[model samples]
Target: MEPIQLTTAVMTIVNASRIIVQFMQNQRLKNQARRRQQHGDEDMNTDFSKATVSSNLEIMVLLGQAHAVERRFWARETSTEWWDHIVLQVWDDSQWLRNFRMRKGTFMELYDLLSPALKHKNTKMRAALTDHKRVAIALWKLGIPDSYRSVGNQFGVGKSTVGVAVMQVANVIIELLLSKVVTLGNVQVILDGFAAMGFPNCGGAIDGTHIPILGPDHQGSQYINRKGYFSVVLQTLVDHKGHFTNINVG
Candidate 1:
């Protein structure tokens, strides 16, 4: 063989080996890039799964809160057995007069007169209270020395309901009956009766008393009377029949 040919053959072999090395390096770089892209896709999928789970948990929590509120909306339950079972069925006429400060007949007559004004119809929430029950509640509150809460317990109603009923009954009575019942009828007849009783020319008797009261927010000291108690003055005049003709309070 010639020396130049041998040298050319060695050069060719070296060129082929360099080409193979370059091809192997390119393949390795492409493999690494593909592995990195796969890892990125996996991470994106994991993040999306976590967000979906979080949203579902938030929806479940809101539903639970809504159910809890619904359960607590109307929790309190009061008994009506006192007025329905005991007072209506068990009590007698004497018991009625003692508790309400009037006979049953008078109470019914008053109910008949006032029912048109005080009547209420039943609604979706509850039954309306009877007119007689309302009248009894008001009379019991006025005649008995008890708190509104106590009166409500006996009447099978709320304390606020008792207070409202008392005010309503009182206002109605004043509007309907005050002028006719509290007036001095026939002035000469009243004077003659007073004269027969040896009180000449006197039509009525007048007196004043201290009514016990809670100390007011303003002028509290002024309400302290000579008896060392808080009170308001109630002055009244009465005819010969001992019926009230005039009244004043402060």
Candidate 2:
């Protein structure tokens, strides 16, 4: 078993190294050509230029690397038409992976399902947007409210892109995270003794509170809740010992 594991690990490393080498070679070719062009060497190759553009391995490596870095546990499928495809994967299942595939969907289906414009205005642009890494990061960050901006910054995307990604992925989270009633085990482990000390069920208790929000011009009366203020209602649940169990935003 140990030998087999070691061999598998080595093979994985070797394959990865080969890809990296190919990537470096591609970049070197591009850099040299770019420098030559910048230096005013106007020897424009007729067929060679077309061949080089078509055989751009660096671009391939970049696409692969981008996906590798951004995506976690990704898998995908393609359609007969080169223009159409889908991808599939799960996220946030590192610890829970042993249990099951946490979040589930075909990648292309997911992109198609969530994309504001189902079909890209440009065919080439749509293909690029379907990249596994880019989409995965965007989708994951959106689901995490606080992490959206931070994650978006890492990928050089704006906050709004992150916001849209989150909204798109929010449904998956709701299905996975909220499908089950707050389990006793989940609450107790997270809350740590808050459940037993006369708190609510499964070692958690809930409290309602009001928070201030920006007022609207069109309908001033729209903001009023039972408390009668321009506020949003928030619910916080704590475990038996009073550690935070969950937070709900209105």
Candidate 3:
């Protein structure tokens, strides 16, 4: 983990040293050449040239050192794709689900089902990312509302990229997954199971839940419920199995 940091520090030092030595050597050679080329205003031109060369060499060396240091850090980070480490065996399945909000197999199955539609196109600039990676990015974003940067850090992507992934994946889920996963057939199964438990004719139970919100501008007071905090109402139909058979947002 720290080996990269140590290597980068060494690279910075080496680059600075090289820049200094090369600058000094170049100035020495230029001075020698200038001496050889000196045929007019010997002392005056020599002093002026020496001063100009010295200042320019110092400036160049500073700029080179800055650039090399920047390059070293950038190079160190670019080589690693941390998202792979999370998806692969570098991290355990438990950790993956804890962060991603779904089992690995479930995520993969979803990715496969949606890949044809969700998979990005390979443009002239770069190849498209895999469907699994895109889904992971979306899951992370959904799992925490204020976690764009955190998700980006874990997935080795930018916050804007994470946001885009979430939007695309969410559109796919709303279009294809929602109806497929929750339908009349699934609702009937839940009702039958609840009936078997002696809760007859009860299709689903209704419950009102208050979900606290920061409230939208211009009409925040309207959203303030009896609980004191500004929140929207969530009327949910939950089955005996503790699954949300249906939900109505207010």
Candidate 4:
């Protein structure tokens, strides 16, 4: 080959190699730019996530503080209980006996007589009166004819408790004390008692009376009396000693 032609060929080969090297360098620059863009996007995303986490924690803290303030406000606004004022503030035995019209011994005795059958549980959640207190309440209802609310206020119990106690004691007394308190099995003794009262040959003396009662639900007019009020007939039989021997009530 001639020297001039060989030199021209070598120059062409060197230019081609330089072109390839320039293209590779451009590709590497593009790759480095893409890598830097990706890393920048990742860092921005991490910073945004950190900001979001900080905001969420601040919101949770605010909610916790709000709830604590609300709870404290409610707790400070609460009131005292009723039972605390009533049972501790005003309770007297003499006033209790005067209101119930029975001695303590007699009340306890009657309670002992009727307590086995009068085991009634209060459906309402309240402080329950003892057996003696229950009997006293029943006697107060019978003797004084006071309102249940008044009796409850005086006795340091709820009105419902007073009403329930009266009803339970009355039911127990009627069921269990009827046979024991009034009986006619002792006919000779009853006749002798009548004879002592100057009424001979009479087994017993029976008397009829009317007791004032509240208007009944079903028949209010039927119980109206000459006094222009409701009443129930109470018939009683007694021996000469004034003790009840036989009794009938309607």
Which lDDT values do the candidates have, in the order given? 0.78, 0.53, 0.72, 0.67
Model 3 clash count equals 0
Extract clashing residue pairs from model 4: none
Tens digits of lDDT, candidate 4, 131-213: 65677667877888789878777666667878898888888887999878887657888778778878888887789888888
| TM-score for predicted model 2 compared with the true structure | 0.31
TM-score (C-alpha) between model 1 and the true structure:
0.64
**In order, how many clashes per candidate?**
0, 12, 0, 0
Model 1: lDDT equals: 0.78
Better model by lDDT, 3 or 4?
Answer: 3
Range of the 10 consecutive residues with the lowest summed lDDT in candidate 3: 71-80
Q: Where's the lowest-lDDT run of ten residues in candidate 1?
A: 66-75
TM-score winner: 1
All-Cα superposition RMSD per candidate: 25.6, 20.4, 11.3, 27.8
Score every model by TM-score.
Answer: 0.64, 0.31, 0.59, 0.57
By TM-score, is 1 or 3 better?
A: 1
What's the candidate order when arranged by decreasing lDDT?
A: 1, 3, 4, 2
